[model samples]
Target chain A: MSLDNEQVQHIALLARLRLADDELGETVEKLSRIVDFVDQLAAAPTDDVVPMAHPLNAVQRLRPDAVTEPDDRDHLQQNAAAVSDGLYLVPKVIE
Target chain B: MKGQWEVVIGLEIHTQLATVSKIFSGAATAYGAAPNTQACLVDLGYPGTLPVLNREVVRMAAMFGLAVNATIAPRSVFARKNYFYPDLPKGYQISQYELPIVAGGELFIAGDDGAQKRIGITRAHLEEDAGKSIHEGFDRQSGIDLNRAGTPLLEIVSEPDLRSAREAVAYMRKIHSIVRYLGISDGNMQEGSFRCDANVSVRPRGQEKLGTRAELKNLNSFRFVERAINFEIERQIDVLEDGGEVVQETRLYDADRDETRSMRSKEEANDYRYFPDPDLLPVEIDAAWVEELRSALPELPDAKRERFVAQYELKPDDAEILTASRALADYYEAAVSAGSGAPQAVGNWVIGDLTGALNRDGLDIAESKVAAEQLAGLVDRIADNTISGKIAKEVFDAMWAGEGSADEIIAARGLKQITDTSAIEAIVDKVIAANPGQVAEYQAGKDKLIGFFVGQVMKETQGKANPGVVNQMLKAKLAG
Candidate 1:
């Protein structure tokens, strides 16, 4: 129901984000408060209720397996930081 | 290999669905395009882009479920497997987590000990593939090709029933055959259409507890699957033999070195915090629709192999080989029915020369230059004694070269069997008369000399002599 500084730091790490040492306390408190608010739902008696994938009672909409999207690489790559040979370049990943 | 240690292997095969577009987007899924041309806004992980399920992929997953005798889950949920990778633009792969599309299936594979062994399918879940990380030709950076992103993939996880690397490959091959038969996947490993990751562990012969497992990744080929599992098993056993504990980790199989190494340090390794994605709802498949897909599925490998053995009177091994692929089995059956060739002989032709030619020319059975009826024509010639078995190979070669039909080729090349008894007798007589010293040697109790005379007769007839009739006539004449 609550989170610790270390747990929040690990969560940040998994999300590929960094929480500064000075900002860690505030972030952990905010995350813990948010978790506690959501955790209240677990206190309710709902043993007979079916688990839901979404709050809405609707099923996923399916699309026909057809190619309708056009080449939007140029438009999309305008937002990227780097590009080469039509490939989006990033920092070296593999060791 | 299996020795004092018992190796248990399980495989997770990622089969790229043969859908025309990406699983969640309308972007094209064609491979090897102009890098990012096929990638769209949704595939590029732009904010506010949502994924919609592709109907064809759901149908394909159900078909595979039925083919493997698995249960198609009526309600399947998608989850986000959170990870950080440059190739995965979304930073989280949308995959099935708690509930999957297909579950509790079993596939029968040829066991390493030469028996049919049943391998359990734990589950098969639909997921999106990550883009390619082009590490080559980049200095201190990696290039990302988003064309592969959002492509549909069915991650089939198998239970650890395989006892050896051979069994693992056999199971992988069986799954490959099923997917290909269902037309759900092209199953092309070279182009990354099909990929496999194996979890291998070793145990003592009588040990009930399994050893620590190392999940081996990047095994894209069947041979690599077998070799990687074998190498990982040996590595584990070696660690145990030296009194060192086998560490649980993800390992990468180095195809160049033929060994597996730990992919990342345990400290920084991936811990995928999987949760239901809020953007997508549960996919509800109707039981009747599953039945409809079942009716549409082609005869699976096992059923086809059994039918081949019964209908064609073929040996089990031969039937197995002939029914390795639906196209191959269909070709064999078509060849058998379209003409008067015996089913067994036609099966042999399809499994032998046809397969040989397909392999030699790097052609799929569907791309075979020779049609089934054409091959059946050649088989019919052999069956009817119009051409000796030896000469049929020549006819087959000519047919492969687009020369013409068997009858046309035989007529044009004068390659027909010398079936007329008198004509064949004349050649046999000429051969005996021309080789008198060998004939004298044949009469002097050299029984093998009949082969010499038969060869001479075949040469005289230009290999057109019916081999069976030549043998009988040669035996009778050489008896004197």
Candidate 2:
């Protein structure tokens, strides 16, 4: 499938990415190629096989309900640019 | 004003599961912790962290599925709901999409005509809750508390079967009661453990097609759910009558203003881009495990109500009220066991007096000042004819005041009933002799004077005479 500039811009907007006019054409072309490559697998002839979520056949492991983690907020928030009273701060989002 | 129109409502209730830890991490799930003290690396969506399934959450979902008669999937998948928000550190939420753990069930609520109404449950799925974002006292920024993030939530979706606000409240309340009864969630709306979103719309009464709906968000209480839906219904009708088309959107319920306004920020964010989460494999719950949870299930409300009717021989209304909560039902049964084996009498004290005192004092059954055995003692005294029912009220009030046991109070107050035949007869003779004019009127066929004689006997005995025995002896003395 071929790509259009408008669709690419919409996807970028949804992903919170700002693409300049010069970057839009190349991004559209690359995304179109990725979509086409993924679309090729739709032609496979395995009619009875169930769709799988992962490559491995192992099932998800369950953990017993227990609290083992200690207070690590101070250490975890060290990488953030801003924090107050142990809360991570960000630009205000409207309700 | 909407006699020609019909309202349709469906609800999505998100109940936080009561777990000791987060859904996929070992972080504590306790509420009201400091902003980030309880958050772990996994909850923050840190690098190289993989989400694991919690055994209790899966069991909780299965118990709910069985309780509602839903189909528990043999295998369920988790999908990533992609969105951009600060509260969601990963920019996506782990939720069940195509194949949820529970699907296709119905819960019965009392309809408008006082009959059982089955509201269809579309599906219930497991999801991770988002963090809390505090906008107040922040300079051009919002403070994000990640403690609530990754906490387990069961989002129950219902079909658009509700017809009115009252019915909606009843349906939501039924779900709340079931979750609490199952011991899965605390169902505390004030603490944000249970909340609902309502999809409301209206159309002509005979129209089969549903009108465009506006989703009302953040209805944290039963009253808010009702008021939000009502306001949205009226707003839609007004729009349609004014030749305006209803726009499908998300609206915030302004509880203070009693109105709903379109949330402009969420207007264009409907594309969730859902896909299977690669970090987690499919969760497979076999039949044996499902059966184990089923066998371990507690007695639900419907079964308890039925047993109350058959075992206790209680009226349906009384049974319903007594079984409204597990604690009340347990209290009633314990009282009956400790009392004179009179189920109906014990049930009456529980449903009438105990419930009234609890409400008047702003307390719950669990917080009642009177204990079950103490109440039983009072009922036993009344049954053994040691104290009249009238005097038992005073005893009960004294009990509520923490005076002492029923026996002690009765003895200290000198309020024992005069059940002895000769004792009651002597009081009756004294009353008859003292009120000769009224006795003549009574013997002259003014039969209503019997109440006067009974009153005099009670007054002379200090309201301690058995009214039944007093009536019999007074009638015999007045006749001959």
Candidate 3:
């Protein structure tokens, strides 16, 4: 897969990142190189191998189904950019 | 118009698991908690914090798999679905991508013609829920409540097997009943414990290729799902008939307007670049553990219904009604097990009178004022000739009003049947003497006047005369 300028801008918007007009060309070029480097695995003859999702094949460790956390809303909301009535406020999202 | 086009639908249902804590954290999962109060560092995606799986979520997923006879994957992977939204503190959601916990099951639903149809379940995967974004209160901002963040959800995806909106609703209802029976989820649509998204497409009759589909999001009720699908089907048909192609997009069902509106088009659709989550490991279930869970499973709806039919000698429709909910089935069984009345009578009272009363009072079987034993007592009275069925109904009314037991009501109101032969004989004689004209008319050829004589005798006895005794005495006296 190749990353073009238009696709890079679209991804930036989806990620809520604002890129400068002058930086788009360089960013697109760098992203395309990264994609090309990852695409090198396509040349490998591995049709018989199973796809791996994790580096270590260990199973997940499960915690008991119980409530162990306390109410720390007043403290957690302190890190938000804005808050009101125990809610984290952001610029309006229409949908 | 009926045979013009074909509608194809698939559903994605998201059921919130009934766990005390969040899926990957120890934070509380109680609904209606204050905003952000239940969110911990792991839920909020703090630096260096990692997610630990909750054991109950896997058990619930396995229970659902067993209920649907789905293939329970021995090993399942978690992937991060990348997206940017204010409600999601993490930039991505941990979900299953390549391998899900459940795969390739079938749900049996009643088709439009009342015949059983099997809908193929493509997959059910485990995922964490996003927080709520409240957009109504703020003037130019939205508020995010993270109490629901990291709550475990099983997203069940179905194949494009539904041919109409009715079938889709039936399929959704079958899933709803199964989850409720398993006691894994509350299945409360109003509180959003259960919600569904529908993918709908319409094609010309006998077309092999499916048309471009539109997805309807967050249909919380069964009625809305049906209505939304029907509207979408009509809209697609209209578009195609007008020489236009159907566009693929996500639409929102505006319940107030009773129509769906475009929420996002294909151009703005998020890529959701999915990758396996590094912090979490794959989930693996041993065969022994799966067997243990399967053996410990509760009797599901279908088996219970069959048992009711065979054991209680109930009609299939009556069995279906009784087994609609576990509480109702248990209630019926308890009443029968009280061992005071016939099973069929118990079945009728439970299905007919008791259910009617409960519905009128807007109560569930669990919330009923009439206990199973109390209902058994009422049915016993009718069986043993202590009170007639008519009087039993009166007793039921009194019992519903908290008046007391069947015996107490019958005794307190002098409502017991007049089983004494002489007492009934005297009333019969009084009716024969008082209604001499009707008696002569009855003996002369008007045999239907026997009903009038019976009514007169009943009126004299204040409806307490045993009807059979009254009829026998009235016939003997009239013949003489």
Instruction: Compare the candidates by lDDT and give the number of the best one.
Output: 2
Candidate 2: C-alpha lDDT: 0.91
Q: Write the per-residue lDDT of candidate 1 for residues B4-94, one digit (tens) a residue.
A: 8888888899999999999999999987799999988788888988998899999999999988889999999999998778888788999
Task: Write one digit per residue (lDDT tens) for candidate 2, span A20-86.
Answer: 9999889999999998998889899879998776677788899999998999877888899899988
What is the DockQ score, from 0 to 1, of model 2? 0.82
Weakest 10 consecutive residues of candidate 2 chain A by summed lDDT: A50-59
Question: lDDT per residue, candidate 3, B1-480, as tens digits?
Answer: 647798999999999999999999999998888788899988888888889999999999999999898999999989999887887888899999999999999878778888879899999999999999999979999998888989999999999999999999989988988898999999889899999999999888898999899999969999999999999999998898889999888999989989999976346556888888988888998899899999988998888988989998899888887887888999999999985649889989998889999999889889998899889999998898988887788899999899988888899999989889998998788878887798788989999999998888888877888788888888988999
For the candidates in turn, chain A alone yields TM-scores of 0.79, 0.85, 0.79
Better of 1 and 3 by DockQ: 1
The whole-model lDDT of each prediction reads: 0.89, 0.91, 0.90
Better of 1 and 3 by TM-score: 1
Give candidate 3's whole-model lDDT.
0.90
Classified by CAPRI criteria, candidate 3 counts as medium
Docking class of 1: high
* Per-candidate clashes, comma-separated: 0, 0, 0
Sort by TM-score, top down from the best: 1, 2, 3
Give the worst 10-residue stretch by lDDT in candidate 1 chain B: B262-271
